[model samples]
Target: MSVTAGMESGPPIGVTAGPASDRGEIHNWTDLFYFFNHSLPECHVELSESTKRVALFVLYLAIFVVGLVENLLVICVNWRGSGRAGLLRLYVLNMAIADLGIVLSLPVWMLEVTLDYTWLWGSFSCRFTHYFYFANMYSSIFFLVCLSIDRYVTLTSASPSWQRHQHRVRRAVCAGVWVLAATIPLPEVVHIQLMESPEPMCLFLPPFETYSTWAMAVTLSTTILGFLLPFPLITVFNVLTAWRLKRAGRPESRRHCLLVCAYIAVFVVCWLPYHVSLLLLSLHGTHIYLHCYLTHLLYFFYDVVDCFSMLHCVLNPIFYNFLSPNFRDRLLSAVVHYLPKAQPRAGRRASSSSSSTQHSIIITKEGTELTAAGPHHPSLHFQAPNPSPISAPGSLTAS
Candidate 1:
């Protein structure tokens, strides 16, 4: 009776007593269907309690380790690198910080899952634990949006006037993003409290009508802003960037294409099912009566999809930042600095180190510099058979 006629767990609807509980069992061969509406088979849930504990423990433990190490590595490199801080670097740093929030907060939920969904932590812990879960999710999303906007600005409006004010504008936008993202979890934090079903569970709001209202409000806001708002903007901006690149006779790098494609795919694929289930549960404020089996199926789907959504935090850096050579170089440099064999060398050792580093589409005659070709920071290159003639041997700046 997790969700009863007067209680709401997630769905903003009242659930009637299940058929197994509502009717008497037939001992002998009886009517094929005791009730016409109850003829459908019961929605089966086969995962045992022990199995769930093991699965969740493994999943959360793995995500925590990978996400922690990767995000920390990213933050360390960008902050301590010799390269001057750029708009892109700043965005990546902020995103990494937000992701750390998610990774650090996962342990509380994992502990609860391990205990068979019991809330050993008291009322205060219940609200606090859930708050970080949502805060980081929204923070990561908006930071990604800011990165896209910065890239678009860099490519199209690199004039002198824009350059004068660009740094200040970027700083302000970053602050605003943090403020808004932090504010999103306040409503939930205020209302969430501990509830006991003999095992003690953390329920967001009270049961029945109030619970339904609260759930609908939270899910609708999350779906509308988190997915609907940012998704369209990301798509439109990327499309326009691509079209502009094509018209200018510049082919996008495979790595850049893969990064953007992965971002869009993961954002949509992981989140769509969760929102769809919420919509079904919240149809007409839970006024509509859906079949019992269908409700079970939707709830199950929602739970499974949620696990996938958590994985986005773990993979974001790998797809977007780790693929960049500049990023990797910076990360390696930062890491080596603390090692025993990190000392600088002269003569043969320095020459050997220099020889090992190589970049395609580059010709060094004197000064060598690298700049972002697009949002991705791809190597500056042109498709001409002899591109060297256009920029000479020393300079290779992409237009």
Candidate 2:
């Protein structure tokens, strides 16, 4: 094809040197080479030669599925447990909601990625999409911090004080958390803009003049505020709780401590890489294309971390179903209820025999003999029935 045809066809060129019969002229080396050497310069920006859309779609879809299913399961399993509707549960539910909100924005992000980072959605979407993204992220952080504080309060405060203020505190904290979350994304709404890319089909925009730098700063600050700040507090509280529970010798307390520790560990593991990447990105910018490349790499990696962050949602359900004895028993009963009947064991029937010997109620009381003839027969038990019951083992009973 001719040079013009080559440009139109998009890529590749072939040149031939021979007599030009049509033009009735000689096709020399210079003329032949000139035919292929067009004036068009190669476009500086290039989209991936591969189908980026398909890959991005699959990845984002998986993220949505995993995050949604895990969060839903957590809510479902813990919704009715004793811990359900408690401070911890409330914080977790909020976190799940935040994750869902962020995940909701994935399809939009996928479009941007697929279209080579061009945003086809108008100026309004360009501005608001970021709002959805950061609001949920900040909200998730606030809820996590709330959870840590809840653990701390439950562990350190006097029971009477905690009982009086726990619910009120939780409500106030959650409300403030939401307010903070909503405010963090306002800059995003105000700053985003749309621009043209080399590919007219692609939409591209520069982040507001200083927004990239500002975003990097805010992201780093938020990482510390959201993840690093809460980690130590949560870790210390959980450790103290575990220590206290262990000393108290309560099996349930130990299990609760372990679960909290597991949560702390998971949160750290999942978020640490993302934070590190963010820090690196902040240190560099698009001025270094490597930074831009790393940013894209970190972007996808962060998405994976985002998916795992919602693993916290799955945790509450497991905690309710497995950590609490009563809840576990109920879960087991539910399972057994749905199970098929088991065949009787091939063995001798259990003997129904009973014998009783009377004993003195007190050292001063006279001893006597009593007999029982059947398994179901009532025997003389020594403890007297109390007229009142106490809330705890050592407390005075209420009449």
Candidate 3:
């Protein structure tokens, strides 16, 4: 019942072809050379079914464990009163929540993959799992977009009236994001079904008459909404923010610019290949007859890139929270607060002294002050960084 068990007897997964009569003939020497060069290696370079199962299980399990722990820490550190007040912090917290949601769905997926794509769970579970996973996927990326925009606005806008109304604006934006994310996955809930023929499997199957059209539509929609639109916006805003900081001539602006570039690079490295594969597969589905070798390559390519895309859940916290000195300070304080009383007083004193030596000032362009305290003074205190409404960038705030 393995999904790949009968691959030689049928078309590859996620690919559909026209009839044999419509298949193109290699009528020239050039076509033959192209096939030998491009398609021959794919025939020999494939992993065994057992190898793929074990590799994917281990990969997803690691993502589940690490993503769960780190995202939970982010939520705990940011759930405190002071962390709840800022637009940037709010976006970070919500993004962590969305990443956690995706992590929670991994166990079920791991189980299904281990069972060779079997759907032991009923139809309702199938629909719900797909819905939950896609919703969080959309929301997580949308929050990153919001974070980029907020960083740009923080650097550019300094009006007192805007600051007064930011809380309402933040709430409205978060709510709208959640609403759109929830709505986008309705198709999954409606179209994903638990198939019982040949063997029980979960798949997206529409009416036979409209299968190709539906498949192409879904692929295009996901690519456009998930990557095509949001990525450009994220890049533009982050680049502009970095450029503005560089122009301000702050000592830390170079480092801030580098961090901004890192954000953009990671997003592209993780997502671009996956969306590209989706688009290529959709094109092949439109009754276009790709060579057998190219079809196989596309199938394998999709699998690899899809797994790579899930890595963002693991990387998000590191780039967005763990990189920040303030977040690290908060995490350490939280850990020390929960330690047992039997711990050595000498060790605690050592920690206090070490923390006292580490000091940094973070001044937002809007004049908001953020102070990270020593171990003895565990609470963070916020105030105005400068009397002037606009000031130079002081420290890079990790998104």
Candidate 4:
């Protein structure tokens, strides 16, 4: 979500154009500018500019290709069987779409980094690119939170009233999430501009009169809304979900519970470093007397972690869809459907075996019957007596 380009030689707004000698004495207004520009010449000793550019180009390219392919596969596979739509499927589809949005923006970002943070595109692109990236980033996080909450809710409560309105409620929640995600990036659209400083670059430059205050506000707000607030909610809900699954005393409950915990672990590993860097940058912007070396080090740290955060776009599909047994079955069915001749013998054997096997039924708290084909298929495939939807196995659902 932090799409701003690396700083060049330009003096950002609100910073006085002073001699190199004054660079040693940092002020609040100049701190952000210096932070981006890496005012200390010694910092260049860590990695040469050419090396950094090549490394970033490689990273962005890899993320773009892998994330694009993974999310597209998720969307394509899930898009089928619309008649069997369920809340978990809807969440997976939406989350894949969000991750795809983030992946699509990577090429432009790749080009920007390759050009040494130059913005060859004009003003409209500058705003739209940042807005699109941030919106999807937030939406992806929100959808994960939704997935967590849905897992916990379905596990603990089975009120007739709640079950009756569950689909409608989930639809409304998805719409609200999309709207909130779009709204959160409006400040970026306003503040981000194509600045033709030392070189043309897309940068977030607030008004000069309120530069420091605005910068700090934006940093803190993004950290809070994007990570701080949502992460705790995700952790709590997933933890409770895992706990409930463990108490269920089913054979597959342990594996299912660990998968649930993975949701929290992956989110934290991918996002925590980036938010910590943002907090450090925010602290530096407060004129909190950091040594010159430390300030430069922070800048480098931020750049690394910012790119590192993008691993979520790639990992989301693996965790949310590919890991689910039902989704895998669906994907295989889809593949075989399209390529009928590819595995005819195996398909026949599988179909015969599945049809002949006796299904074991597990009753939920609401007394809904879940039919499992055999021991090989650990998930209890939901078969509601009513029209309520059923979720894919291993998708935050206990078997």
Candidate 5:
């Protein structure tokens, strides 16, 4: 039988057996329930060797690339466009930036996971990684909520004061959001410790005994703030906006309201299950057989949900680049400049020549003097060969 125990903080916490051979530490490959103390089901781990590595690489990289490119584009487009600097886009820009910060930490996690969940990076990175992960998550959620609120305000209010001092509103919203996001990592800094798992995992200190309480609290808070609270507000505001649009008989408003409503709905549906699973996994007696089964199912599904939800960062750029007219035009212009030969304009040669010819017309009108120039001319010679002191509508030389 292989030895099983939590080794001191170093390497991976694997079993070290001797004599015949070393099986290493027995990792709890079973679901959360098994880890908690539930009846052990047959190890149902499904990630294959190659798949795990590829997935780790792809998920982190996609998050980094998509979020970075999209947010950067958002900033550039907004900067160039007359799109008024409002709280909504400001929050969006900051949110995107925060996501980039989180994405920057992903390569570290990716490397650690690929190396069998052992953090090769030291505790400094561990803490920082955990810090930014939560920070980005909170900022994204807060910004989404702020966006919904901004839309609601635009739809609901019509006061002059609201319109006149909108910049102050945006500033306050951004400041508050930044403050909230920056505080989310306090728990991570408090609870994380260097621990030896069968896989040399760096986990929350005190194992489930202490980690469970903190994890549950943090996850529950994140769930409530990130999904639950925002979902209802978004739904209610969108519904009200829709009702008003219908009453006002504006088709465009109705369409916009419906689209935003759908976005909020999808966000809630995708993230809710994952948060619920996290909350349940932290509860006492979660290691029981039933809990283990549920936890495993949820854990697997959580990853799937996250993979889909990560599309949020990807869609941000699309929303700015494709949905927003200003952003779309700028992107198109930039792309055209970058690859001018990719799309040739039809009849461009003829149109350009005609335009140049039409632009050369010069007309001069004076008392009893009229002159006209052709569509193309180097210069117009205006000369009265016969000195005519008589100023009348004589046969003027049409140059």
Candidate 6:
């Protein structure tokens, strides 16, 4: 529906309950949904909306700027050396896109939250924003799983046939993951409708019975698929690799697992609370709706955790850039090629085929070091050749 036309006071078709409720207590728990979190936590206390607006705007703006810059830098660096990139780069590029897409949806959310959860964007945007949010959030999780699986398979398998098919298999799996994540949110988009709570609020209007059952199923499945299963598998692979490396008597530190550990840390720190809180709230949402005073804290906690989880996008680029020496080198290379002042040297470097050797100079807070090997090599405090002198035990380098 058109933005203006969608505001023509559509039917308050769904179940509603409780006195003076902006979100009426539905008699049953049928409206729980995976993507449609359009309801505002009805504040029982006198919380200042202005205060919330200021806090939200600060976070939204900070995340927008930081996530945009970090994601773009990683993507540009990857594509610049796109020709030489392997499956890992491909996955990283996809992850960046997924994270970026999710974070971009926040400005819309910020607008709605600022208005005390009244949605002004009408029907299509209401659905589209939720759709985009879930699509990318799920995609990021799936891509992370894909990366962990890639590492596991590569490390454990030794057969030539497995090696031969690895590239093709990786490409196919990655393609399937994106397509699947993109398709999963269609039902949420279709079910979302706008209703007036004095002002229009976008809501998921799935038949109440369908929500109590299938919607709950969707939420549980997300918890298991998005976090419970993949995260453990990723951890397992890292542990196995560490064990094998130690058995081989290699000097590589267990910190090599740090990249995967950082991934785990982001998921746990950013997402774990959101999922757990969402589950608790979904189960008791009906009770809370009836006894609004009793469960105000639950509602408040859910919104806070859910909103904070968006920071994963901002953190992902920082983790990859700082943790992976390769990412830093590519970023430096991209800056030289694209920045105005570095153009002269970049042009000279590109034109001379005979001078293919590249020197990667990394200046850290503590010192400066140079790394030489091909166009890209490890850099930062972790600079110097492989087996970096500065690398600590448990420190891992990107392949």
Top candidate by TM-score? 4
Candidate 4 lDDT, tens digit per residue, 255-302? 766775677777888888777766665555345545657655655445
User: Local distance difference test, per candidate?
Assistant: 0.55, 0.45, 0.63, 0.63, 0.47, 0.55
Q: How accurate is candidate 6 locally (lDDT)?
A: 0.55
TM-score, structure 5 vs. true: 0.67
TM-score, structure 4 vs. true: 0.79
Which is superior by TM-score, 2 or 3? 3
Worst 10 residues of 4 by lDDT: 376-385
User: Which stretches of model 2 miss by more than 4 angstroms?
Assistant: 1-56, 76-87, 198-213, 252-258, 285-399
Candidate 2 lDDT:
0.45
- Candidate 3 C-alpha lDDT tens digits along 1-399: 112212322232234443324445544323332333343343554647667667767887999999999999988887763344344677777888998998898887678668766678788887777788888889899988887776667667777766677667877898999999999878645866666654566566556446556666777778888888999888888888778778878788888778878888888888888887667755764556566577566654454456667788888888878877667776876776666544223233563465223333332232234421100000000000000001124544542
If both were scored by lDDT, which would come out higher, candidate 3 or candidate 6? 3
lDDT of 5 by residue, 291-329 (tens): 544534543343334444555666655542345443455
Every model's TM-score: 0.74, 0.58, 0.79, 0.79, 0.67, 0.72
Which of candidates 3 and 4 reaches a greater TM-score?
4
As for candidate 6, its clashing pairs are 253-394, 254-394, 255-394, 255-395, 255-396, 256-394, 256-395, 256-396
Candidate 6 local Cα displacement, residue 178, angstroms: 1.0
Candidate 3 Cα outliers beyond 4 Å, as residue runs: 1-14, 19-46, 81-85, 285-289, 342-392
Candidate 2 is scored at a TM of 0.58
lDDT of 5: 0.47
Clashes of 6: 8
Write out the backbone clash pairs for model 4.
Answer: none
Taking the tens digit of each residue's C-alpha lDDT, what string does model 1 give over 235-287? 66655554454556545444344545666776777567666665665653246
Residue 189 lDDT in candidate 6: 58
